[model samples]
Target: MIKRRLNVLLIEDHFIEIMKFKKTVSFAEIQHSITEAKDGAEAFKILEDKSRMPDLILLDLNMPKMSGVEFLSILKNSEELRHIPTVILTTSDNQKDLEECYRLGISGYILKPLKYKDYATKIEAVLNYWSLNELKKY
Candidate 1:
């Protein structure tokens, strides 16, 4: 099977987490391009460009400006952006958060592992799945 290079939008606040994700992708030798957003507001700005719409969005729950659930609500409500696959990549393992995300139509919900190796494995699996799966072009 041909591996598609994904355009991933990572909405994360922590600098270290962003760096770690980039490192993991590099270590895994994945060719996907990543776009970083410090918060949900920044993410909206990035998403405004229809020509550069991401194939997948990896969102973190705790953010300064706008929370992940809030962002997800707005995203899912939009007719134009609703079809883009969004997955919650957060440390929050709260049952309510998981239920809410699923209700908001998130493609997946993943809890961030404490160990680096586990985190890398999960990230790799998520990326691999999305890269191989059929995605709608905007």
Candidate 2:
């Protein structure tokens, strides 16, 4: 069976983090089309335009302009955009941040692993789980 290619929107501020994420995904062998945004503001702009909207979103917590929680608040409130699933992919293991993300209805929260191989494994697990899950019509 052929694996499905995912359209992923990645909101990350750090270039190095983005590079790690890409490398992990590649190592996992997950076929995906990723759209990168430097911060929550940029990601929100992309979300506003329906044509550029993604199948899923992986957000970073602490970002310039707007935070991940701020973006999630708007995203969950929007009737046109609420159906899309979003997960928190961040280095922050802060309890408050985790609680806030859960309260805002994030699909999952993953703390970034320090090891590259471990990171790739976690990413692969996420991809596998989501691939088997069904999405609602947007």
Candidate 3:
């Protein structure tokens, strides 16, 4: 069954890959409006706009200007941004990365090297879980 994609925020330095993956793999399969950010700095800026706060944040590590760790550190301390669930979906499969993300209170962590099909599956799962929780709070 085709699913409506939720509004997703993807924070990656490489915009092309994000766009191509979104289009080619069909995050739009679930009909998601994927908002793109070039780096952690840009992502933070977008978060400031109350109307643009994303339901799920897909963050990448090892970015230029502002790294994902730096952003996570900042975010966890901010009451305004802390409630937004940010997932570390990055190439750093290192244990340290995973540990740090959990310590910073990330909602989830995903390593790279994931198959294209699996990537879509994970994305779909995140959307579903978020939707369920949102409904539960009502």
Best by lDDT: 1
Q: Tens digit of lDDT per residue, candidate 1, span 5-77?
A: 9999999999999999999999765689999999999999999999889999999999998999999999999
Off-target runs (Cα >4 Å) in candidate 2 are none
- The residue-by-residue lDDT of candidate 2 on 1-138, one tens digit each, is 346667789999999899988887776556788899998778878877777678889888889999889999998998888778899999899999999889988999999889988887888888777766665534
TM-scores for all candidates?
Answer: 0.97, 0.91, 0.83
> What's the lDDT for residue 110 in model 2?
95
Model 1, C-alpha of 3: deviation from truth (Å): 1.0
Question: Can you list the residue pairs that collide in candidate 2?
Answer: none
TM-score of 3: 0.83
Model 2: which ten-residue window has the lowest total lDDT? 129-138
Question: All models: lDDT?
Answer: 0.94, 0.84, 0.76
Q: Candidate 1 vs candidate 3: which has greater TM-score?
A: 1
Cα lDDT, model 3, residue 136? 13
* Best-first order by TM-score: 1, 2, 3
Model 1 backbone overlap count: 0
Alpha-carbon runs more than 4 Å astray in model 1: none
Clashing pairs in 3: 4-30, 5-30, 5-31, 5-32
